[model samples]
Target: MSRELEALMLDHGADGVSFDTIVAAGANSAIPHHRPTDAVLATGDFVKIDSARWSRLPLGHDPHVRSRPGRRLATGDL
Candidate 1:
């Protein structure tokens, strides 16, 4: 899933992921910084995605370089 997501981001023009992709399911969902395991997702399990992407623009190119260059983060649960 992480690989797919990374590909998707690259395909969409993101320079790169800002950090490691996190996709936690069930028990792992409670952890904000869980190292993913090979656990298979089951029905009714809580899912969490903490995703971030670096800027497509080069550093110093974006006006808000410090805050915007590599700080995009998005979290979601299901």
Candidate 2:
């Protein structure tokens, strides 16, 4: 899921990821910067995906766009 979000950013003209994508689900959702694991999401799990993308602009700090895009993809039966 995070990979797809990165690809979508790249497709939209973003040079690359400014910060690592956060795909926290269920209890992990409480953590804003949780690292993703191999656990499967459940039906009642609350999910949050925070991602930032940047361009190749020369500046003191890279210009970034932070967002939370939504996707409804199921890996298995609920």
Candidate 3:
């Protein structure tokens, strides 16, 4: 799911992902900055998704180039 989100970002004109996508589920979600794994999501588990993308621009032209902000969503919000 994380990989798919990253692909979608690229499809929407993002130059590349700013970092590895995070898709932490269940107890793993308790950890900050957890990396995605092949573990299957289970019932009652909370899922968190974090992603960031960078857009192409000339060097020193984009102030946010080196500081792309990331957005996060959690199942708890749903």
Candidate 4:
């Protein structure tokens, strides 16, 4: 899912991800900074995504222009 999100960011014109994405699901969501794994999502589980991307602008052009988007998901919706 992190890979997909990274691809989506790139598709949207981002230069690249600023850092490794964080995708925590189910009990893993309780972890402060859980890294993404191959764990399958299940009903009643909670998911969290924390990611940031660099702008398409050239490096050093604008150090302050980063894109950080975060979201939480509940598998129950699936």
Q: What lDDT does the true structure give each of the candidates?
A: 0.65, 0.72, 0.74, 0.85
* Tens digits of per-residue lDDT for model 4, 1-78: 889999999898887788988999988988879976778988989989999988745586765478788888897766
What's every prediction's RMSD, in angstroms? 5.6, 4.9, 3.3, 2.7
Q: Alpha carbon lDDT of residue 62, candidate 1?
A: 67
Which residue pairs does candidate 4 place in steric collision? none
Model 4, residue 68: distance off in Å is 0.9
Indicate whether candidate 2 or candidate 3 has the larger TM-score. 3
Q: Alpha-carbon error at 69 in model 2, in Å?
A: 6.7
Off by over 4 Å in 2: 56-78
Going through the candidates in the order shown, the clash numbers are 0, 0, 0, 0
Least well predicted 10-residue stretch by lDDT in candidate 2: 68-77
**Which candidate would rank higher by TM-score, 3 or 4?**
4
Question: What's the lDDT for candidate 1?
Answer: 0.65
lDDT of 2 at 67: 49
Task: Write one digit per residue (lDDT tens) for candidate 3, span 1-78.
Answer: 888988998897887888888888888887878976789877667877777887768787863443344444444334
- Kindly list the per-residue Cα lDDT of model 1 for residues 2-74, writing each as its tens digit: 6787788768767667777778877778787878688887767767776666654556676221112222222
lDDT of 3 at 70: 47
Q: List TM-score per model, in order.
A: 0.70, 0.68, 0.70, 0.82
Best of the two (2, 3) by lDDT? 3
